[model samples]
Target: MEKKIADALSEIDGAGRVTVVLTMKAGSRRMLAEETNNDDTSAVLVSRGSGYQETVTVQELSPQYQGALVVCEGAGDPAVKLKLVEAVSALTGLGSNKISICKGK
Candidate 1:
């Protein structure tokens, strides 16, 4: 996710060598649910499959973004820094105060 944010921010005209450090209030965890199987009869059947089968799932969670530090070239300029702050705020649903921008090393 940090890499994606850095890639997005690096597209700005004045942004270069972008570095983004993300801080989260809590880490995301998986949700669990109970499942039951009632079949008790014993029966054996074997079948050959030609291809692999896999199940993939994507789950959405609430925001955990607490803050972030962004360092990039030309970020020393007040205008550029402000722009970066706003951009980060919009992307992360965080207030400007939570996002900090500084000039790249």
Candidate 2:
């Protein structure tokens, strides 16, 4: 996760050698949709090869983000800081208050 964010931030203009630390509020979760028939509801199943079956997945949810800290050479610049904040918010569903951008080597 840190590597992914670092790679993404490295693309920003003047954002050199980015490093990211992310804190999660919770782990990834998923919802399994149910199927209804004859007024009865039950778990949906997906058929597979060789008569195998598996539970049908309805939705996959990303982890809840607690906060993020971004370190980069350009973080001292207001523009770079703002961009990094916005990018981290979009990627991790974190608000600006939860994101900290700091200048680093």
Candidate 3:
């Protein structure tokens, strides 16, 4: 999954696009709070049963490129969010460029 994500990201190199992946716990308060503001970003929330099982939010951080698409892979684990961020950051050499996980319900 990481390789697939990385491959998709690699195509946008030097094209002025930034991609990020995020995972959130099911029915997390933090996740609910963040989902209040959703606009112009790509996000997905998946449920395994009755509640919000997990979520993956991807955001493209380049105004110059309007056609950019953010891809999110659901892992059902919040702990992997940091690792995904770090991996993407390292792979793209994008440091602190105002990227955020979109709010979702």
Candidates in order, TM-scores: namely 0.68, 0.81, 0.28
Which residue runs of candidate 1 sit more than 4 Å off their true CA positions?
29-59
Which has the higher TM-score value, candidate number 2 or candidate number 3?
2
User: lDDT tens digits, residues 1-105, model 2?
Assistant: 889989999999989989899988998998898989999999998889999999988899888989999999999899988999999998998989999999997
Residue 66: error of model 3 in Å?
12
Clashes in each model (backbone N, CA, C under 3 Å)?
0, 0, 2
Better of 1 and 2 by TM-score: 2
Error of 3 at 34 (Å): 52
- Return the top candidate by TM-score: 2
lDDT of 2: 0.91
How far off is residue 25 in model 3, in Å?
33
Give Cα-based local distance difference scores for all models. 0.79, 0.91, 0.39
How many clashing pairs does model 1 include? 0
Worst 10 residues of 1 by lDDT: 39-48
TM-score of candidate 3 versus the correct structure, residues matched by position: 0.28
Q: Highest lDDT: give the candidate number.
A: 2
lDDT of 2 at 91: 91
